[model samples]
Target: MNQESRRALIRKLVASRGECSVEQLAVELGVSGMTVRRDLQALCEDGRLIRTHGGATLGERATFEFAFLDRVNKNQEAKTAIARAAVRLASDARSVMLDGSTTTLAVARQLRGRSGLTVITTSLPAAAQLQHEPGIDVLLPGGYIRSASPDLTGSLAETNLELLRAEIAFLGADAVDDRGNVFTNPPDNSAVLLKMAASAQRVYVVADHTKLGKPALRRFGQLTQWAGLITDEACDPDFVDQLQQLGIGVIVAPFE
Candidate 1:
C-alpha cells in the first residue's frame, strides 16, 4: 500500500488496539520493522500517538482527531461522488486551492495522480494526502493550528492565502440554504474562506445532500459568488430548483 493508506491503517490499528508494538505493525502491514518505526514516529509528531519503549498508544489528541476521522467517513458514498464531480471541474487548473473540510480532503485524494499541479491548502490532512505526490507541489499557509480540526486559521493564514493565487478553489460548507448562502460551523473560518475564494479565479462549493437547505452558525458567502455548487444525486430536486431559480449554477454528481 502507499504511505498515505498505510499510515491511515496504522492510525486505525493503534486507535482500535490502544497500542501496538513496532514488530506487530510490521507484521500486520507486511512491511519492514524500519518502515513501521518510521510510520510510528511520524504519527507521534502529528500528535496522534504516544510512543512507548517498543510500541505506541493513542495520544491525548487522538480522541478529537479520531472523531474528525469518523466525520469524514459519515457520508462516504455522497462525498466520494461529490469529489469525483469536483475533480472534473478542476481538470484544467494547474493551481488549485482547497479548504479544510473533509469533503475537500476527498478532492485531494482524487487529485493525487495529476502532474505539474500546485495545491494550496490549510488542511493538514489534505497536505499529508498529497505530500508524497511527486507531481503535485503542496503548500500550507502558516497560521494557528485549530484544535477542533487539523487546519490552519487566524490572520496569518489569511494573509498568506491573500498573497497566493490559484486557478480554481474547492471549498466545503457546513450548510447551504435555499437562498444559496453558504455557512461554516465556526465563525472564524468564514474570514479564511473568504480569502481563499478571493485568491482563486473560480471557486466551487462541494457539499453532500445532507448539507442542503440548512444554515450553520456563520454565513460565509452566497453561492452566486462562487463558480458553482457541486452536490450528490441524493440532493433534493426542489432545493436544486430553488437555487437554480436564484441563478446559481448547481452540478449534481451521479453515483457510479
Candidate 2:
C-alpha cells in the first residue's frame, strides 16, 4: 500500500484499539518494519498519534476507552485466574488499593464477603461491587472520572491516595518486562498507578500472561517496586525467572 493508505490504516487501528505495535501493524499489512516505521513517523509528525519506543498509540485528544466492557471478552479465563492468584498475595488486608483493570475488578468481587477490610479502588465497577459488602468499607477516591474506564485520577485523587498508607496495593498493568519495567498505555494513567503503589507497604501486581511480553507506551514502575506478581501459566518462563532472580515472587494460578 502507499503511504497515505498505510498511515490511515494505522490511525484507524490506534483510534479503535487505544494502542498498537509496529510489529502488529507490519504483520497485518504484510510490509517491512521500516515501511511501518516510516508510516508511523509521518503520523507521529502530524501529531495524530504519539510514538513510543517500539509502537505508537492514541494521543491525548483521542477518544480512547479503557473500559472493562470493551476488554471483558478478550481473556476471561486468564483474568479470573490472575485475580484468584492475586488475592492469595494479601495475607492481612486492613486497607487495600485495587488499581484499575478488569482483573482487579474480579479480585474486588471476591473480597465482597471478607470482613474488616477497607477497600480502595479507582475502578468504578470495583467500587460498585464492594459497596454492599457488609463487612467491607469501600472508598472511591473521587476525582475526574475518565469514562473510557470510569477511573478517578488527576491531582485531587492522587492527593487522596497519597494520604492513606495501606497494607497492600494490588496493581495491574498494560505490560511487564523481564527487566522489571511495568508499562502503561498512557502516561497520566501510569502516574496514578505509581502513586497508589507508593501509598502501600507491599506492592503486588496482578497481570494475565498475555501482558508479559508486550511493551506499552508509558511505564509505571520497575519490577523492584513490586514484591510479587500473580499470573497464570501463559507468562513467559524467561520473564518469570528474571523476576525470581530479582527477589520478586511469581505465583501462578492452579490450572483448572
Candidate 3:
C-alpha cells in the first residue's frame, strides 16, 4: 500500500478497534514492521494517532492500554486453569466484581452455573455472558465503555460502584511485579481499577503469568493491599514465594 493508503487504513483500524498494533497493520497492509512503525510515526506526527509499546491508538480518545485480542486468545489453557481456581475462592450468597481483563472473563465463564450470586461488573462481555444464568443475578454498572478493552470507566461507573460493595473483587492487572505492584497503562484506566479495588472486601487480582513482570505507565497500588494473586501453573514457585512474603495470598492454578 502507498503512504496515504496506509494512513487511511490506520485511521480506520483505530476507529474500529480503538487500537492497532504494528504487527496487525503490517499483516493487513502487506508491509514490514519497520514500514508500519514508520506509518504509525507519520500518523502520530499528523496528530491522528498515539503510539504505544505494541500499537497506536486514535488520538484524543482515552486509550486503555491493551494487547491485541489475539494475544489473549493464545492463552486459553492457562486461563481455564486459572478460572477454575478463582471459582474455588467464591463463597455462598456473595457479591463479586469482575474487571475487563480476559482472565477475569475466564472467571465469569466458570461462575455460570453457581447457584445464587450477585455479580456486579463493568465488563459488557462478562455481563452478557452471565445475564441469562438461572439462579445468578448479573448487574452492570453505568460508565463510558472503553472500546479497546470493552471496560466501563469514568464517573458513571464510579457512581454505580460507590453504591455497592462486594465480598470479593476479581481484578485484572496489565502488569504486576515480584514486589506486588499493580500497574495499568493509562492513568484514567488506573482510576477505574482503583475504584473497583476499593469497593471489595477481598481484592483478588486474576492474572496469567504473562502479566507478572511487564511494566506499564500508571501505578495503582502496593502488594500488601491485595488479598490474593490467582494465576496459572506458569507462575514460578520462587516468585510466588516473593509475593507471599509480602503478605499477599497466592493461588497457583493446578497443572494442566
Worst 10 residues of 2 by lDDT: 61-70
How does candidate 1 score on lDDT?
0.93
- Cα TM-score of candidate 2: 0.71
Task: State the weakest 10-residue window (summed lDDT) of model 1.
Answer: 183-192
lDDT of 1 by residue, 1-256 (tens): 9999999999899898898999999999999999998998998998889999898999879878788889899899899999999989889889999999999999999998999999999999999999999999999988999988999999999999999999999999999999999998874488899999999999999999999998999998999978989999999999999999989999999997
Error of 3 at 110 (Å): 0.3
lDDT of 2 by residue, 11-44 (tens): 8788888789999999998899999899888878
- Clashes per candidate (backbone, < 3 Å): 0, 1, 0
Number of the top-ranking candidate, with lDDT as the measure: 1
Residue by residue across 112-222, what tens digits does model 3's lDDT show? Answer: 988779999888878888999997898888898776667788888887888788898988777888888887666347676778889888888877888886667777887
The local distance difference test score of model 2 is 0.80
Better candidate number, 1 or 3, judged by lDDT: 1
**Of models 1 and 2, which has the larger lDDT?**
1
Q: Which pairs of residues collide in model 1?
A: none
For each candidate in turn, the TM-score is 0.80, 0.71, 0.72
**If the candidates were sorted by their lDDT against the true structure, best first, what order would they fall in?**
1, 3, 2
